[model samples]
Target: MGQQYLFWFAQVHDDFRIPELQSVAEIHGFDLHIPQDLDASRPFCILELDHEEHARLLARRCILIRSVCEFYARGSTYEELHERVRQQRPRWSCYIEDTSFKFIVTAYNHTIPQARQREVVESFSYMDFLGKIDMKSPEIIMTCFEEYPDKHGTTRPKDEGDGEFKEVFFGRLIEEGSARPLVKKFDVKKRLYYGNTSMEAEISLLMANQTLAAPGKLIYDPFIGTGSMAYTTAHFGALVFGSDIDGRQMRGKDKQPGIIRAASQYGVAHCIIDLCTFDVTRNPWRCGELFDAIITDPPYGVRAGAKRLGRKSRQDKEQPPTSPQNIAFRRPDDQPYIPPTKPYELSSLASDLVLLARYMLKPQGRLVFFLPTVTDEYEELDVQSMLCDGMEIVANSLQNFGSWGRRLITIRKATTEHFAPPSFEQLDNVAHIPAHKDFREKYFQGFKKSDVEQISELSDQG
Candidate 1:
């Protein structure tokens, strides 16, 4: 039987932690049972692994998981917890007698006082010791977790401590999670290039994690804004390639060096295969079924405007230069004409991405992308229809802050043997933009639209 372990998950991005962990676990062929429909808010969870290497692999891939530990004891009360630990005292003495170690306590929904924490640490000092103590760097790290009496993690004095804890756990730490430092390594504030809608490094890596990013895999990003997705995938050793609709975005518009700096900045330049200014709707990729994954954050026309190639407007026309300097600065006629872009609706963007992934992705390959829309708009569009063709939804994780939230949908291409795609009608639903609901109204749901119009009218009159 595999050894048992306790996983202390970080309390953030609650909705995404499970899907991300499960996705990675599936890739490694490690079957982990987390029966409690747990969220990040609940920090304590148990993981049963067949081997210690398997536990380390899980920790290496997870940013949400703070750390994994060697399972020691678990119980409903501190007394039970200590009693269970007592059972292992004979065995633990051998592991700890001559080892340098540190005991850290983490209390969920409650804070363990320093005095109480000291007591907990000292309680374990009964074990025979020969090695010198080293708190800065220990060969062995020990941990104790105190789960509160209720979901809120409240505590009571020893006089009335019967139900003070729902669960208590003690374990030997395996290794600290690799993700916390990665978060700091890829922090947006330190990025050489970023945008109004640039995906945060943490979430960017989450998208990469959902796909199980690995060395030699091909990852494509349809809408590579500041290349957060690209950088993350490349960082994982995947050969990353992507494009932006506007060449200006990649070539540098106003001192923004586009996505190239991200590679150089991150020192993962070799992993970046190619980044171009190509329309996703058009099949620019000649490498059929060559990509192993596709990760992107398609523009939602909210923070950044979503656009596609289309006919030029009335103001777009070539005119004779009025001066010698004007002619000198004029775009060379030999230069290829770059088409103008029109508004690209959110629904249409989803359709093109899925269709592109069908041919672009090898069967069983993954696609992870974001979809942010108003609840009303989302229902009207029927998000299921988005994956009706050529793919199946592996996981759908939502991170909703308020009225508007984004869903990260991970998909795998359905092979011919198991290819049961949605009918043409369902695929057609992707292009169908529901009735022109008040886009502005729903976006600013916090404020009334009528008042916005009233203020606009007043400003115009003034």
Candidate 2:
């Protein structure tokens, strides 16, 4: 008279949840019957059957199912009432049929005492209990008392000494280890151009794990400030290559030796390049050379004074100063060069991204980049437009760290064999744009002209 039950775990993202469940199923070597329109909100379900062990096996694989409860009840205390009920019962009590009654016990109450809870749990027989209970409108109740230390200095409860009563009322359900599967670890540090932290490295590892980059595949990072992105990718078995405009900033005299050292420490192969320049407008990398994936955190509107060229004063501007304004800021060892324009524009930041996408990425390769969304339009709209034609946005997620609005955009190159551009025109008729007033009213709070000017100036330097 044992019973069977079906259990399921609630998951956050439906996209990966099925895969996780399938992985669990494979481990247990069982075929789970999933309803086509199953309700995720209702976490667990039970089925009455002869084989209870098979039900337990299914429960173990469903790690997402947090807790489970079974239905059972003992006989009434009144002997005369029981005898009257027995006289009305059917003759075949010992060999009950499966469809005898459909007792729906939806509610339960805990009634077991703490001291005798364990002993009570060991004595109850699931099979025997199922046989005795009336199937219709059964009361599902269990007695269990849990101990909690008095936080407000309250007195403890006096002993009642009812061990046998406790054993008859409640029992403990044992859980099988079916849920937590082993996850592969990527051991490396990640330093975002925006900032450096252990959390950023962990996030990068999570993103990399989602991609199909295999071991020995080249993972390139063009804007490898301190090699955080490169480090995380390499730790997962991909060969990493990182480059920075100023290699000195990567290691200097004391810090870790950039991506090269990071890869070595993590037991991954890597190469580092210094002062490499590639214009995004035109693909600069040699043809035929490509990477399996590219991940980077482009430099935001922040600059080091020593690393930046300064502007000439207004007083000296009319005369066209004999020496360039940035001459004073250049390193002592470096020779001063005259500025072609009054204030030499820093290298275009957006162009670097375009170059990386066009020249470096392989066909069907994936890219995960973090960009700050401070302005209404990103500076590299042209590059984005170009990418839109050949790439699909897989995920656009936001990560807010302090004042920065970091947007993580994951994109994958269109599979050329069966690729077709999305028909935006067809959807435009139904597309809704939030009113301009709504945006201005919500985001313009406490915003001043000076703040915009300051942000504009920062974007120029980088």
Candidate 2, residue 433: lDDT: 29
Q: Report the poorest 10 consecutive residues by lDDT, candidate 1.
A: 417-426
lDDT of 1 by residue, 1-462 (tens): 677788888777877877877877876888766667554456777767788887788788888888999988998867788888888776477765578877798676566767778887777665656676789998888889887744434455643442366788999999778866788888888987777778887899899898878887988887887788888888878898878887666656545355777678899877888878877765355556778998988887566767776533543455332455654566587886555566666665676667767767788888899877554345734556666566888777777755567788898887743332212122343355542233434554443557778877988999
TM-score of each: 0.80, 0.45
Candidate 2 lDDT by residue in tens digits, 201-312? 4445434543443466777776566666665565546776665544554554545554455555555534332224332222245453367777776654333211222235
List ranges where model 2 is wrong by over 4 Å.
Answer: 1-199, 254-256, 269-284, 302-355, 374-387, 400-404, 415-462
Error of 2 at 159 (Å): 22
lDDT assessment of candidate 1: 0.73
Best by TM-score: 1
Candidate 1 residues lying further than 4 Å off, grouped into runs, are: 27-29, 34-41, 87-93, 124-134, 148-166, 253-257, 311-336, 375-381, 416-441, 444-462
